[model samples]
Every structure is written in structure tokens, then in C-alpha cells.
Target: MSKPIRKAVFPVAGLGTRFLPATKAVPKEMLTVVDRPVIQYIVDEASAAGIEHFIFVTGRNKAVIEDHFDIAYELEATLKSRNKTAELELLSRYQPPAGQTSFTRQQLPLGLGHAVWCARDIVGNEPFAVLLPDMIMKAETGCLAQMMQVYAETGGNVIAVEECDPALAHQYGIVGVGESKGADAFAITSMVEKPPKGTAPSNRFISGRYILQPEIFDHLSRHEKGAGGEIQLTDAMIRLMADQPFWGTRFNGETYDCGSKIGFLAANVAFGLDRPELNADFRKEIARLLG
Candidate 1:
């Protein structure tokens, strides 16, 4: 049996050029969606999926993320003195157990594969998960948790995929499948990153969640640059597929692409509407705005 996927790598090293002035001072993953920061959602998802270790691959100016995960002793003491039980409980829940989380620096604007590769020493030879903090998924079960079930059966590499409009298939890393495992699972025969407009082999695109084997490090370590002159994780995965089995599971949820402006606004609204305190008034305000 394959080693259990105990650790998850979060690639948050990118400079959020798209988010502009806001990102100039803050890491994109530190941006708030409704109430919680984007990285927190990814961490929550991974934690729910039984991920024991959280490895963050960050870059310069991203120190806030590391601090956010650490305990604030003075604040905790102040809350305790004030008898703020509820607030203290909430704060405690956000912190992972000591030793469960680790942080490393990428120190370059390379690519996803390179960012993941930075975690090589910590990951060692164990199968680990890679979750992009930008793709915040809303599901009955966390997206990574859902994929974990598929990993238990497949015991190789598994990626989360969702169908996209054929016309827009060129915008994503498309996967070609050989057979269906079930309504929500398939065996991936091949994967192509951002194919030409109408030449994509399949309309289904790879979403941000991945359960990868350790052998991928060997492929990524080559530092070979692919599309856009950077080391692409998809390229490494393609190389890994030459030897191991790869499967794709269609996750059950709405994934908001928070990497873009519109996607970020939409996610805020979607998450706002889901909040018990805000739902009713928020829905009415949205309807009024539409009207």
C-alpha cells in the first residue's frame, strides 16, 4: 500500500500582481474572503481531510501568514483577563497543534512546480498533497477530503478535475481520460496544460487540489521550465505518469477562483450569503441591487 498522505504543501509564493496595491502590502493568501483569510480555508479543508502536517512554501513579504498561524500570547492573555471565552475559543481553533505546521521560503518567482519542490526536504519520501490556496471550494465535505477517499482506492496520484466549457478549455490544464471509475472518478490517460483554443483533447480541466507521490520530486528537481518559461507542475506530473497510475476525481462543490478580481468578488458574495447572520439581509440587498 502507498504511504498515507500525511502532509499538504501550500504554494503561496507568487506576487499577487493582479490584486495590485492591496497585494503590495499583503500576501494574496492573507486576503479575507468574508471572515477568514483564503489560506485558512485551504488549511481547514486539508485538516478536515486528515492531513497532519501543513507545509507552507512562501516568499518575501509573506511573513504575515506565518505570524497568523502562530499564537499571540499577549492577545490570548488579554482575552483571558477580559473573560472572553468565546473569542478565545475561536482563536484557539485556528491554530494547528504545535509541530504540525512548518514553513519554508521559495525565495524566487519561479513556478508552481518549483514552489512545491522547495518542500522536498520536509516531505522526504512520503506521498503528500498540494493545495492551491486560491481555489477555495465550498462542499459538504472539503474538496481535499473528498479526494482523499479516491486516493485510498487508487493509491497513486489523484487530481481534482471539473468540467469546463470547451471554448474556454484553453485557459486551464486539461486532462484526457481513458475510462470512468464512477460518476465522479476517472483514470487520466494524459494531461495538457492550456492547449490551443479548439484543440483541447478534453473539456475537463484540472482544479487546484492534487495528491501526488514522492517520485514527483525527482521530476520537479530537474528544474525544467515548461509553459511561460517556468517549471510547471503539470509538466512534472506528466513525466511521473510515465511510471505510476494517475486518476482524477470530479469534486462535489463550487470552486471560486480567488486569483482573479471578479472571482474574488463573487466568492465574497457567495460566502456572505452562506453566513447565517448575513444571509437574509445580504440576499435582499443583492436582489435590490439587481432590481
Candidate 2:
């Protein structure tokens, strides 16, 4: 049997220039989708998917992200004094067990591939999952968990994929479909980073969740820059793919790219409406705002 996937790497070093003023001092990952910071949702998903070790590849001004996972003693005390049992319990539930979390700084804006490479020492010689916090997946089964199911069946690289409009496929990393592995999973014949409009191999675009073998570090160590003149993770994956089999699964859910303004606002509404206490009122508020 393949080694159990017990660790997950989160690449959170991106400078959120797109979000601007709001992200000036706050790490974009700390921005909230609802009541929880964006990174919390990603970590919750990883934990639900059986990831025991939480590794964060962070950057400057990102200490808040780390602290969010740590205990807030003064606040906890305040909540306790106020007898806010539910609020205090919520905080405790979110804190990962001691030593289960580790943070390493990326230091430079090298790109996603380099960020993953920064965690090589921690990942060692085992397969691991990489989750981009910006891509929040809403599903009955966490996207990474869904991909883990595929990994268990096919012991190689696995990526979560979603179909995009063919005309817009050129704007994302597109994949080619091969033979079926079973269910929504399939062999990935090709991966192209933003191919020209009509030349995309398929409409399926990688949705920022990956299960990769440690060998990928060797390929990324070369620091070869590809699209956008940065160390693109897709470039390293393509090199790794030459030797290892790759599989893709279309997760049963919606993905919100919180890095974009529109995607962020949409996620808030989507997640807010998902809460039992807020659903009815939130839906009505949305209708009112629309009018």
C-alpha cells in the first residue's frame, strides 16, 4: 500500500497586490470569507482530509496567519470571564494540537514552485499534499479529501480539476484527459499553462489542490522560471510527470478563487448562506441588495 498522506504544505507567501489597500498590512490569507479567516478554512479542510502535519510556507507580514492558529490567551480569558462558552469552545476546536503545525518563511516572491521547494526539508521523502489557501473549495467532501481518495487508488501524483469555458481555458492551467481511472478520476495526458484560446488540450483546469511525491523538490530545486518569469509549479510538475503517472479528479463542489475581488465577495455570500443560523436572513439580505 502507498504511504499514508499525513502531511500537507500550504503555499501562502503571495503578495496580494490584487487586493491592495486592505492587504497592505494584513496578509491576504487573513482576510475573512465569513467569520473565519481564509486560511482557517483551508487548514480545516486539510485537517478533515487526514493531514496531521500542517506546514505553512509563509512570507513577510504573514505572522498574523501563524498567530491565528495559535492560542489567544487574553481573548480567551476575556471570553471565559464573560462566560462565552460557545465562543471559547470554538477557539479551542480550531487550534491544532501542539507541534502539529510548523511555519517556514519563503522570504522571496519566487513563485509557487519555489514556495513548495522551501518546505522540502519538512516533507522529507514522502508524498504530500499542497493546498493553495486562495482557492477555497466548497464541497460535501473537502477537495483535498476527494483527491486523497484518488491517490489511495492510484499511487502517484493527483490534482483536483474543474471544467472551465473552452474560450476561457487559455487563462488557466489546462489538462488533457486520458483513460478513466474510475469515477471522476482520469489519467492526465497533458498539462499546459494557459494555452492559446483555441489550442487548449481540454477545458479541464487544475483547481490549485495537489497531491505530489517528494521527488518534485528535485525538479523545483533547479529554480527554472517558466510562465510569468517565476518558478511556476506547473513547470516543475510537468518535469515530474515525465517520470511519475499523474491523475486528475473533478471534485464534486464549487471553488472560489478568493484572490480575486469578485470571487471573494461571492464566497462570502455562498458560505454565509451555508450557515444554518444565517441562511434565511442572509438570502433575504442578498435579494434586498440586488434590488
Candidate 3:
């Protein structure tokens, strides 16, 4: 029987060099999508998928990220004193229960694999999910939840994948499709990180969500560097694939790569439209702006 996926690792140590001045003081993950930080959306997604323990691999200047999930006594008191029940309730809903969240620092900017490896102690000997904060998956059923469904049946490693433009496939971690495992999943024959344009196995690219076994820690511990000379998670995954099975599920959702300006702006627009209170006015404002 497969063990329940109760923990999730969030890698949020990256320096947002691309966003420049805006990201100079703010950690990229703290950048808001609509009103909530990008990390909040990812955490909400994991919580919806039944994840109980939230492990964050963060770095310097990321203390705000930690505090965001912690209790703000003064702020809560102020809200309560003012009879701001709705605002207080919203804050409470966003705060994780005490002891449910943990934070560890990644002293260096190693890479994605290394950031994940930093959480080895917290994850211990269990299967856990890894979510990239930069990718905001907008779906009725969260992306990680969809991958969890696939993991429950397949019981190895599961990756959330989505079809990208063939011309842009080389820009992502492409996977080769194999036999169908179900309506939404397929056996992954191969995985190549940023393959040359036309040489990509398929148009399907990994969509920043993962369900991995504890054994992956053993591979990542080796600290082998690939691609850009940093410990690349793709390299460790490729090595792990030699023995274990890998499955990919094309989730019913759209992904916004908030690490990029375009994707960040798009997510704000999309999420704004998703809000019941703002949908009508938001659309009219967007239409006016476009006009």
C-alpha cells in the first residue's frame, strides 16, 4: 500500500534577479498575485491536497515569508478591537496551525535540487510533495491534488505535466509520453531538461509539481551538478529513474510562471477575475485599459 502524502516541501530560495528593483528588497515568492503572496496560493493548493506538514527551504531576507504564516498578535488584537471580524477571520484562515509549518535556511544559492535536499531531515523516510512557488496552478482541483490521485495508484514518482508549444518545448523539462496509465496520466518514458528545440521527446513539459519518494534524498545528497553547474533536480531525477517508475499527469489547470513579469501580471488578472466580488468590475477595468 502507498503511504499517504502528508508533507510538502517548498523551495523558495531563489534570487529574483529578473524582477530587479521590485524584487530587490522583497523575496519573489512574497510578490502578490492579487492580494495574497504567491507562496500562499501554493500552500493553499497543498493543503487542499491533504498535506499536513509544510516545510520551507528559504534563504536570507526571506524572514517575511516565515512571518507571513506565523501569528501576528498585535495585528490580530488591533483587528479584534476595531470589530474587524471579516479581516480577522481571513487572517486566521491563512495562518497555518501552530507546529504545522517549519522553516530551514539554504545558506547558499545552490539550485533547486539542493534546496529540496536541505529539507531531507524534515521529510525523513516518507514520500513528500515538492511545489515550486513560482508556478501558480489555477484549477478547480489543485495540481498537487491531481498528482496525489495519480500517486495513490501508481506509487512511485509522479510529475505534473502540461503540453507546451512544440517550438517552446526546449525551454522546459520535456518528457516523452509512454503507455496511458489512465485518463489523465501516462508512463514517462524519458525526461530531458531544456532539450534542444526540435529534439524534445514530446511537447509535454514538467509543470513544477512533484510527488517524490524519500529515496530521492540519497541521490541529491551526492550533490552532483548538471546543466548550469549547480545541483540540478532533473539530474537526480534522471538517475533515480534508472530503477523506479515515473508517471506524468496532465492536470486540468493553467500554470502561471510568476517568476516572469508577463506571467505575474497575467496571474493577477486571472485571479482578480476569479474573485466573486471583483469579477465584474475587474473585467470592465481590464476592458477599459485594453481599449
Candidate 4:
């Protein structure tokens, strides 16, 4: 039997240069999609999938993320004094229990692989999940939960994948499928990061969610730089696949890449329309703007 995945790593050490002034001090993971920070959505998903520990691989200027997850005593006191019970309850809903979260510094702008490697000590010898905070996934069952189901049966490396236009294959790590594992899962023969146009094995791109065995640390420790001269996680994963089973599951969700400015604005609109309190008015405003 596969060891249950109890820990998850959130790699949020990037400088978020795309957002510039807004991210000058604030970590990109702290940016709100609608009302909740992007990282909270990911953490909530992990928690729903039975993740017991949240490990954050951070960098300089990321103290705010630590503080975001930490309890705000003054703010809680003010809310309590005002009898803002509903607001307090809402805040408490997102706060993970004390000692369930851990933070460690990546200490460099290496790459996604290195950032994940930063959490190796905490992950130890068990299977762990990796969630990229910039991808805001919307689904009825939650992407990570769907992945957990696949993990339960497959018991190996499981990656969340979604179909993208063939023309945009260069923008993502495309999976080369070997055989069908089930209706929504496949045996991944290989993965190529940002393959050149027309050279992609398939249009099914690897999204932000991953359930990896702890042995991957060995490959990442080499710090091998592939595409863009960075320690791409795809490279480490490719090496890991040489001796282990790697499977991909098509996620049951719509993902918005909030790492980009346009995608961030679109996520706001998408999430805004989903909120009951703001839907009608936000829909009207959007219709007016488009007209």
C-alpha cells in the first residue's frame, strides 16, 4: 500500500516580478482572488484532500505570508469586542490549526525544483503534495481531491493535468502518455517542459498540483538546470520517471493562471461572478463594460 500523503509543500518564493509595484513588498500568494488570498484557496484544497501538514517554501520579503496564516490577536480582539461573530467565524474557517503549518526559506531564486527541495527535510520519507499558489482552480470536487482519489488507486507519482490548445503547448510542461490507467488517468511516459512548437508529445499540460514520492529529492539535489537555465521540476520528474511509476490525471476544474496580469484580472471577474452577494451586480457591470 502507498503511504498516505499527509504533508503538502507550497512553493511561494518567487519575486512575482510580473505584478511589479503591487508585489514589491507583498508576496504574490497573498493577492486576493475575490476575498481570499490565492494561497488560501490552495491550502483549503489541500486540507480538503486530507493533507495534515502545510509546508511553505518561502524567501525574503515573504514574512507577510507567515503573518497571514498566523493569528491576528488585535484584529480578532476588535472583531470580538464588536460582536462580529460571523466575521470571526469566517476568519477562523481558513486558519489552519496551530502547529499544522511550517515555513522554511528557499534562500535563492533557483527554480521550482529547488524550491520543492527546500522542504525535503520536512517531507522526510513520505509521499507529499506540491501546490503552486498562482493557479486558481475552480471545480465542484476540488482538483486536489480528485487527484487524491487517483493516488489512492495508483499509489505512485500523480500529477494533475488538463488539456490546452495545441498551439500553446510551448507554454506548459506537456505529458507524453503511455497507456490509459482508467477513464481519467494515464501512465505518463515522459514530460517535456515548454516543448518547441509542433514537437510536443501531447496537448495535455501538467497543471499546478503534484503528489510526489520523497525519492524525488535525489534528482532535485543535483540542481540540474534544463529549460531557461533553471532547475526545472520537469527535469527532476523526468529522471524520477526512469525508475518509478508516474501517472497523470485529468483534473475536474477550470484553472486561471493568476501569475499573469490578465489571468489575475480574469480570475477576479470569474470569482466575482460566482459569489452570491456580488454576482448580479458584477454581471451587470461586466455586461455594461463589454457593451
- True-structure RMSD, every candidate: 1.0, 0.9, 0.8, 1.0
lDDT string, candidate 2, 54-140, tens digits: 999999999998899899999999999999999999999999999999999999998999999999999999999999999999989
Better of 1 and 3 by TM-score: 3
Q: What residue pairs are clashing in model 1?
A: none
| lDDT (tens digit, per residue) of candidate 3 on 1-291 | 999999999999999999999888999999998899999999999999999999999998999999999999999999999999999999989989989999999999889999999999999999999999999999999999999888888999999999988999989999999999878889999999999868999999998999999999999999988888899998899889999999999979889999999999999999999999999999999899999
**Stretches of candidate 4 exceeding 4 Å from the true structure:** none
- Give each model's whole-structure lDDT: 0.94, 0.94, 0.94, 0.93
Model 3 regions more than 4 Å off: none
The residue-by-residue lDDT of candidate 4 on 242-278, one tens digit each, is 8899999999878999999998999999889989999
In model 1, the worst 10-residue window by lDDT is 177-186
TM-score, candidate 3, is 0.98
Error of 1 at 145 (Å): 1.0
| C-alpha positional error of residue 114 in candidate 2 after TM-score superposition, expressed in Å | 0.2
lDDT of 1 by residue, 188-262 (tens): 999999999988989989999999999999999999999999999999999999999999999889999999999
lDDT, residue 181, model 3: 86
Model 4: which ten-residue window has the lowest total lDDT? 224-233
**Global CA lDDT computed for model 1:** 0.94
